[model samples]
Target: MRMMKMTVYFDNNATTPLKDGVKKAMAEALEVYGNPSSVHACGREARLLQDMARRNVAAMFGVRSEQVIFTSSGTEANNLVLRGYFACPENLEKGSKLVISSVEHNCVHKTAVDLNRLNGVSMHMVTVDRNGIIDIDDLKLTLEKGNVGLVSIMHGNNETGVIQPLDKIVALCKEYGVRVHTDAVQTAGKVALSFKDMGVDFMTVSFHKLGGPKGIGAVIMKADIDMECHTSGGSQERNRRAGTENIIGIAGAGACTEEWQVSVDKMQNQIGPLRNKLEKGLKQLSNELYIIGESTNRVPNTTNVIVPGLEGETAVMSLDMAGFCVSTGSACSSGRVEPSRVILAHGIPADEALCALRISLGWQTTEAEVDAFLAAFGEMLGRMQKAS
Candidate 1:
């Protein structure tokens, strides 16, 4: 039973392929080699390109250009938000406490731990239900305890694609005079997101997740928030994230975000149907198979399936051999064999969490690709079951 080698990427949650617009933008930016921080003519040209990218990103996220701080990656952006706010002497004196949802991305989760371990920032985790929705009551209870400086919750889970009740979470945090930060790395381009509407004090987004080049991410903050810079050196990014701007990556990010509304529309109208089709096919293959966030409101492009008695790593490798790409969990934690902590946070058994598979679609994902992936996945499961 030999399977043909055909590439069908279902790992959009990990990273997406670069679009033509992004490639064109990056290609043009490569020729602008001037340092944006310099005052010379070449410098001004580079600065112009970088500023255009900032404005495009700001417009896409519905924020002012000045409020977006560019960082090396989503990990750096998350670190900046956590360390910048909590490291300030006044903030640390007022409240050294930080609260975060249990299902946050590794960048957020790991940074909070590091802050607590090294900086004495008291960390509290708000629990989530089996469907990966945050426990609102648990969050409220944590807030009531007081001395909480910030609450960082992701807009959407990277593994489950479960959208948190951010509006409610923000409102509660505001009542307690606590600032809120959401890692919108997974939600920003896949759905209609508004920084003003969500009302969170800060948000983070990664460009690679939106079909842009890697090594670029942004932190969207309110103009009035007095946060310190984590990467201190020259006065770049308005002295917030001090480093030479990644002009090329920024150009790609800018191009990807220019048509944000179009991307959202396609995800809703076109990609969502294909995702539903994929889930249906998965279910029909095995009665024991179940999706993690099926009934809950999730991002339109992701599906987290748990196949009973099958290791997620094994499924991923088996599918890879057939040229279908999928994932067991976040790309950050890909090589680890342990069950997903995010999935375990949902109260799923550890054994079942190990059986999880994440299939994330994108605007480029077509019906034929979805069908091919489904066929390949079904074949892998058949072979596994027969051997067992």
Candidate 2:
């Protein structure tokens, strides 16, 4: 006589469960028993493992090994780009402005806010369409105002999963002689990412987004770009990021990178169908339900649906009670009860944003899981409507 566990995770955009084999590699890394900075044999062993991980992850993203600098998380990687550039004492005095998209991750958005408040960093917010696509004309107009040293945007949005036209954005910035950086955390393992081919000056990725361990991620910078270090302490990350490296976490990330394509293929073939089925089923349940970025190109794993007449957080809680995991907005801001700023950025009414429910799928999702979520969601909507 046992009770069944109410668990069906659909929030991969927030974070993913560790990939198979990552645990063993990370646990073994702990036994290395050496500081990578030391010059002895034990230290060399740890350094070798660290080098191997750096090379493996770099190879996976089609970038040079030297360009990758590991950070504590995707958040740090992002802050490194936003804050690191502004850390230059002379740049702040020169009034170098940072142009950020309205739909960017909070790490980027909030860091920009702090820089403007603390330092004299000027900030400009670019606009996005209803489909969550960045407006190139708006960006061009902003850059034309001058003193734009760096432009920060994301390759794939975490909330709506809308894939930005990075190539276009990069080209546009190049014409204005500005460096471009993209938060590519949500793109890994869900789509093919060629860091160099994308033609971006700076791009970052999260290990956990690719089914690797959490607290380990990297920012890939192009050659000739002077990266001002943010985390200062003893020399590490080739004198880029400071403090002791997360060796165990990096090892797990390397293991995941070694077999990342298995995840990509699974997302395309398996998870894509599940998403389509889920969307189709939701449509059948109610015509009032529609996706935020439905008409645009998005990663196969994410679907941000706005269920009219129901509060998103309430729907998320009801589904959680029904053995499913979904989110009202970005997990970084999950504690807040306000409507999604990303949705509001689309120029929709504030009330529409209150109905947003972001359900992201992953490699481990199955057909049965999708069916169960759809059924539970339909029932909840039916009850909510009936009571109304």
Candidate 3:
């Protein structure tokens, strides 16, 4: 039987395809050639567009419009929170500690490392369970050690799709009088977020992950938390972040958030069935396939499966050539062939860690695409089995 030809995309956790509405919104904004900071009618028009974008994003997080600060990307947002917070005059004292989870994205991990190297800051890493969730007791033990400046925990594990117990962590932080900062990049649009309810001191989100344009993101800070400005310039973002904003990208992010608010139910319905289909097909291909974090609560559209005796990079390449897009681990470090830190953190052997692959579905992923992937994936696995 001849297999059907298809171009299947399953790397939404890396980045998503821009929606038509978001593209249209960005195109419309691009026609307005005016700096938002200039004192003129054109500038006022641009400023209005920017304000609308802020309000749209704020609505998604249930925060005030002024509380959201736009940045170049999620990395910049993470840097601003990690570096900017400790650099503030109020927090510039010695012996300040910063705690982050073991499975954090490189943006968070590298930022912490850089701060420790340069600023004499104490960096603590919170351990995670086999399910990729931060061990709350360990976090409390770390918090009790000293004057904890910040607690940076991710809402969702980008690699394993495990959702952390954020509310419990936040409550514990409050009891200890510690400030919390959550990297909600992966969970922003896919899961429900309420700034008022989450009660974290700061939160970061990226637009590219949510079907919006790249190079634009937002950091939501509590109104009272005084963070030093990372980029100093004219009074934009209420003097929180500097530089003329990417107006078109901001507009696109706003459109994406608005559309998500209205169509979340539809998206949930569409992606869940496809994820289940992929999981079932992969398990049938080989019972030895270990699904990491399967016993824990995970995002609806992400699956991390370990194929024994096969290198993840080789499998990823084979699948890519077969017209299926997936990932070995973090897309930021995809070029490297090292075993994933996320998989290793789950107590998987170092050699076994090299066998993990992550397949994440998204809005444009269809049933036909998933079916095509299964057929190609089965063939690929059969070849690997025979060679081994």
Candidate 4:
């Protein structure tokens, strides 16, 4: 049986298809050929382009130009907030406590653990419901325990497409006088984010997730909050992050963000219907296939299905053979054979978590691709089950 490979991409959460506009903007940045740090005309021009991109990225979050501090990636941005925030001399001595949601991306969760092990910082985790929504009541109770300096929650669950109720969490954190940060890497361009409205002390955004180039991201924080520099040496990014910026990647991200803001609704309109069609198709596949967070409000582009009687990695490989790209968890962690920690955090049994497959849509996903994937997936699942 010569089954010619038919590629259908459903792994946008791992990384999106590079947008044409973003590529063009990044190409233009190469012509500016000046050190953003230098005082010469070329340097000044580079600086101008960087600032313009910074302002545009900030605007994506409804934030001020000064608040967006560029970093190497969203992981770096998360590290800056978690580590940099505690690196403060006064705060370090206080034995400050930081809390993150149980289902946080590895960057946030691992950083918290490292801070606890290396710096002796106090850390806590607020649990989430089975649908992967942050347990607000549990969070309030944790805050009420007092001495919690910062609470980090992600705006969207990459695997499950579950969006946290950040407004309520922010208001609760404010009441407790604890700083709050959100890993918004998965949500920024996919949904509307109002920095002024959600009112968290810090937010992390990634470029690749915006359908832009990788290797660049930014942390948008309030004006009043100050942290020791995450990276030391020359003063760049208002003495916050100290590295020569990724001028090209920043330019691409800026262009991507701008394009998203203009056409977000169109993207969603296309994504929503296709996602619904896919989900409907999955339901028809078998009664045992469960879409995690099916009952809740999920970001339009993601679906996590627990295919019983199949290993997540097995399903991923089978789908790959069938010409569909999907994942078991965050791309960073998917290479390993571990069950999803995010799924485990939701109290799903380890076995079920190991069987979960995440299918994430993107701006460029077409109905034909969805239809193709559904057909291939259903066939693959049937074969896998028959073998069992």
Candidate 5:
């Protein structure tokens, strides 16, 4: 008789499990079927739910509720800012360039490409170092060239968990009077975040990356930023985004955000130690193993490991067979045969990038589970190395 392997989840950075409070809120919201646009009693109740969610999300970001614009996903939120901000005639004036980091999520990178290809907008990509941190000098030189309207960078990388020096980046951009945007999807609930402190013009976050339901994200814009509306329909989201709000997802996000500080404390106090333990165990398992961004300041729950002589997809399969859930890189970029673009952007060779694995912890991860995963990974790697 074979014993069943206990299921272990280490892919929280891809998408986290919904918290109990979020589930309860979403369940209650499901009963609210009335359209928020209508002025009847039912519609008023629906609108109240959305309004409450809006307020809760606003409180998490330390911003006014009016500054939060809900969108379908983080990708849509990023597009709204990149596309909508550039849509303004003033921003699109000749020679006005959009500066982005080379390691941005595909949403930001692809959108920048489309903006350049379709709209004839100028784009400059700042490179990153081996640790996946953006080069501050490259950014400063690009801004010095003049004609930059906005600078978009991610707060913490989803794949490598590397945290960028937003203070330095923001301060430099401020000196040049250029707008800045950061995708904070992976950092919002896990780290202490202050919109006012970061001093960015716009920030994007996805609820599902935390404990909220999917299909809902928010773009936190500074009060003074003038961005044109991309989607035109209803007057929802203060006319910034025009669509009937997703009440269920919003309710979940609201409940999740209401307890944001608690989650941050847990991540820092609980998950960080577990991640450190996993990294130490992985290094001890083999001298050939490498942990990406290990020395850099990274998110508490994420560890990106490079296992020599093994492909990430193969390891993912073997781990799945052993009842472990992990990821090769971003969930958005999964299924492609190519290596991670984010890793390649850091000057890592494509072959090494293909061998990388991202393990992200969460609120419920345990020491025993981490140890078990280490054992399983070690065994699988030994077998793969022998075969190679």
Candidate 6:
């Protein structure tokens, strides 16, 4: 009789499985079944739950409860920040200008482009080095141009896991009187984030990225910064965002954040050893293979490697068939057979970018899973070598 193998998942950067505590919290909230905005006993109960969640999220970032505005997802939170900032009455008079890093996620890049096309906002690109770290000199030069309203840079690269120099960038922007926004979706729960200390004008985070339920996220904004409402009609999210509050999802997000705070130290210690083991095993198989963003400081759980002479999609499919799930790049554009823009921006050849695969670890991942992945990956590389 043939034996069936168990599947192993290594793509936590793309999305994480919901934590048990988060699920339980959401389930408890679901039983309330009341609109938080309505004025009644049930509504009051729902509103209290929402407020508690807000406080929890705020506490995570060392900000006031009023500063965290809930949104549907990280994408929406990002859009809200961009649109809200540009639409501000004071900024509207001077015409808005946007400066963003070349390696930012598509949501940020596309929004900047849209602002340029529709609102006559000027868009500038901040180049990054081969290590995927943004050039502070380039950012300063771009910000030096007067009339720069906002700078949007990511706290970390979603594909390469490279962390941007936020402290330096923020200081430069402050010197130029330009507001800064960071997409912290990748770094939020993975790292210890304090908005009050970070001092960015705005930062975006998503619950799904950190073992919480999907379709819920928040934007942490500085109290004094003025932002126009992107969604209108209701008095939800302190009039920052409209539509009904996602009470269940918000409850889950709070619970998830609380749990993360408890386990962050352990997670930090565990992921480094696992990543080193995986990288060492991969390197042993072939020295020709290279790790992208290896020269820069990066998140512990991620490793983006380029396998010599093999298409990333082919390798990803082969691993999938072997019961090991991984990704070529951003899961958003995974199906397309194109080189990753993040890789290309790092000055890697387009063909070489096509050979890159990203393997990420998670809190739930085990040592046995890593060992199994290494064994399977070695076998797959051998097969590819023979076939070539």
The TM-scores of all predictions, comma-separated, are: 0.96, 0.95, 0.95, 0.95, 0.96, 0.96
- Candidate 1, 48-71: lDDT as tens digits: 999999999999988899998998
TM-score of 6: 0.96
How well does model 6 score by local distance difference test? 0.88
Q: Is candidate 1 or candidate 5 better by TM-score?
A: 1
lDDT for each residue of candidate 5 in 1-388, tens digit (9 for 90 to 100): 9967449988898888889999999999999998888899999999999999999999998999888999999999999999999988977663368999988998999999999998877899999999988899999999888899889999999999999999999999988988999999989999988899999989999999888888999999987766888888988887788988888888898999998899999999999999999999999988989999888999999998997668898899999999899999623336567888898898888888889999999988999999999999989978977887
lDDT pick, better of 3 and 5: 5
Regarding TM-score, does 2 or 5 come out ahead?
5
TM-score of 4: 0.95
Q: Choose the strongest candidate by TM-score.
A: 1
Determine which window of 10 residues in candidate 2 has minimal summed lDDT. Answer: 329-338
Residues 1-388, candidate 4, lDDT per residue (tens digit)? 9967447788988888788988899989989888899999999999999988887888778888999999999999999999999989676654389899899998889999999999878898988888988888888888888878789999988889898988899899888778889998998888888888988989998989868898998899998886989676989988999878888888888888886665468557888789999999999998888999899888889999987778888888889987888988623345656777899998988878888899999888888999899889888977877887
**Candidate 5: Cα lDDT at 122:** 84
lDDT of 3 by residue, 167-230 (tens): 9999999888889999988888777789889989899999999899999998998988878887
Model 5 clash pairs are: none
Q: What are the lDDT scores of the predictions, listed in order?
A: 0.90, 0.87, 0.87, 0.86, 0.90, 0.88
Candidate 4 achieves a global lDDT of: 0.86
Residue 92 Cα positional deviation in candidate 3, in Å, after optimal superposition: 4.0
Tens digits of per-residue lDDT, candidate 2, 1-388, equal: 8967558999899888887789889989989988899899999999999999999899888988888899989999999877877787665544489999999998999999998898778899999999999999999998888888889999999999999999899999888878888999999888888887888888888999878899999988876766678766888987778988889988988899997778788888889888999999999998888898999999999999987788888898899999898888723346766777889998877777888999999888999999999899989998998999
Candidate 1 residue spans exceeding 4 A from truth:
1-6, 330-336
